[model samples]
Target: MTPTHPKASLLTRLARLVRMGSHIAHGFFILAVRYPHLANAERAVITRAWARKMLSIFGVEVRISGDNPGFYPPNTLLVANHVSWLDIIALSSGTVSRFVAKKEISDWPIVGTMAKNGGTLFIDRSNRRDASRINGQLADALSQGGCMSVFPEGTTSDGFGLLPFKASLFESALLAKSRVQPVAIRYLDAHGQQTGTLSYVGDHSFGLILKRLLSMKKLVVELHYGQSLQAGEGELASRFAISNAARREILAGLNLSDDTPDTARQTLACPQAVTQ
Candidate 1:
């Protein structure tokens, strides 16, 4: 009830901060040490619990709808719109899945090390050849019953809109013949108005974002898990078609307008088109 309790006592704020720091430290230790030796199932259990603790510390609640991946094919791929780094935290809270992140993220301070330990696959979009490499690796993982997710939008967007998805990641599903699940993530305030505080886009530096997040009273994210399907589930799907289907489903779930411009085009990579 941070919103109603605006004058949060110094002790209360300090408590939240200490708890958040402790959770993050504990998570880092697990990722850096113990998790690496655990079986896939054990890693999933520990990571999911750690993520939920982190979410609770941040005072961010995730409300899930549609088909929770927790109950679906374990080897499926999850595709979703990217809003902020927090998206990963929210998703991890729902279920555990390896993430497909940008190569830059793999070098981002503690986050980078943590991502590597959490089994993230880093994509260097500039190198087309790397796509095939990742595809092969992803196929191997999928065949072994691993679930992976990518923000096919190729970039993050404000909560009110969505960018088209880039099609490359779908190659994994094609190679593994796995189901692709489209998800939409949106941040809302206490009164249910769209909140952009969680967006890690534009000129927002990491430090600025951290400050804003810490200052905010509460954050609510809605996770809409849309339909999941394989290339030949209904109509045969080309990679482009699959990518489009994922984006379209996410757009619908967030109730975002299709015509929303690519606001991040100048700064973020504007892929040819949005596709699975």
Candidate 2:
């Protein structure tokens, strides 16, 4: 299901062009802020407007199922699986939440710049000390009524399944007493093949994946927002319970066969431990 070489190159070129345009749009916003009259909500409106424009320029199609924009409360933590970089753009356009991205993304050329400008929280997962520090920062952000989007899977998959949810990241939610909402995203080709090879897993480079996406005639992404789960009595128990519930909801939405590698299947089957 991987894209052909020629198509991949085209998608990359298109991605570069889109990035250039988004930068220009962002610069305009910065300049607009010189006038002291814009309030915080007004400024946010402008940024979101630009984000919508950027997505259109990049040719990413987004579809939503369950819960409109106002359905969930503010300052909630959105948990979802990782598939492509587009997941960030897609989710951001649909919700007013900052991203919790890996540290490597902060250094990723144009993509990194855009993510930082959009107020992404970059975490250095390789260092436990740094991770602990970021956890405090995340708590502060949530306390201030800011919403954050996180991918519990820790890595991207081939768009055919869900990965295990890392329970550690749920710590901030516990600290802030924030509710967790599970979101599921699926990328489909024109012919409706689930795994048309747009995944950026294994040795596949971002450049190659971007190229394939741009050359696509019609790309459709389905986003499903599952019911929100509140932090319960215990941190470990709540993390496990919410993670498993979110996992099942996502799997059901994608219509994916529950059959997979033994480990993945077992992880999905076990209910997350709950606190009293």
Candidate 3:
């Protein structure tokens, strides 16, 4: 397997950072203001284009494979294994959907503001009641022909294995009868070998991860979309089964065994964090 890229020159990293900041500013100040007036289809087009540009600014290329549901069908719940903070950007390049993220993410700096404006649904994991409220909102959105993406793993991984899925969120899919599309995401080097160049796990500061990402020569994000799963009529038991099945599909897409441990397959070559 090919190794990760050596750090880019300081000047190159600075330039890329500047471009990304400018792009984000444009989205924040310009596009966000006009988003409310755009139709759903128009919003999707703009969202996809902006997401592609964002990744391009970071010098990351996204390669989509498997049952690629172009732009994702309406009322679909796109489930995926979490790998990096950049996972949203990679997936958004091919499909447009509001994301379900933790309440803490909505409190982050620019990212939080952007996410809120981009129609993300933030759930307060510490509050059990907040989950039910979010589920109601999800069902309402999906019933209104909206698409959403949720990472059932609930945390970032090292792109080698997956965490067990939280079945509670799948309840929204059943409520709306939304199709669950399992997507497997990976951060790889130019040669297509998996790399932890972008894993945003543990206590690594966001700024530190950003700098490492900026320094990488080439980062490839692969999204392997599995077949759409029908939620069918279900109670708690059915939701649990569906969640497990989704995890299985994602693991298969990552070419990992169902019993694969959460340990990293290869050492992450970037800055390491001592704790989450």
Alpha-carbon lDDT, every model: 0.74, 0.64, 0.78
Query: What is candidate 2's local distance difference test score?
Result: 0.64
Task: List, residue by residue over 103-192, the lDDT tens digit for candidate 3.
Answer: 776677877787787788877766877777888898899988998888887677777778877787788889998888999998887566
Please, what are the lDDT tens digits per residue for candidate 2 over residues 75-108?
A: 6878776777667667766765677766776676
Regions of candidate 3 where Cα sits further than 4 Å from its true position: 1-4, 233-237, 263-276
Whole-model lDDT, model 3: 0.78
lDDT of 1 at 20: 81
Tell me how many residue pairs clash in candidate 2. 4
- Predicted model with the maximum TM-score: 3
**TM-score against native, each model:** 0.88, 0.78, 0.89
Off-target runs (Cα >4 Å) in candidate 1 are 1-11, 260-262, 265-276
Better of 2 and 3 by TM-score: 3
RMSD of 1: 4.0
True-structure RMSD, every candidate: 4.0, 6.4, 4.3
How does candidate 1 fare on TM-score? 0.88
Q: After superposition, how far is residue 85 of candidate 3 from its true place, in Å?
A: 0.7
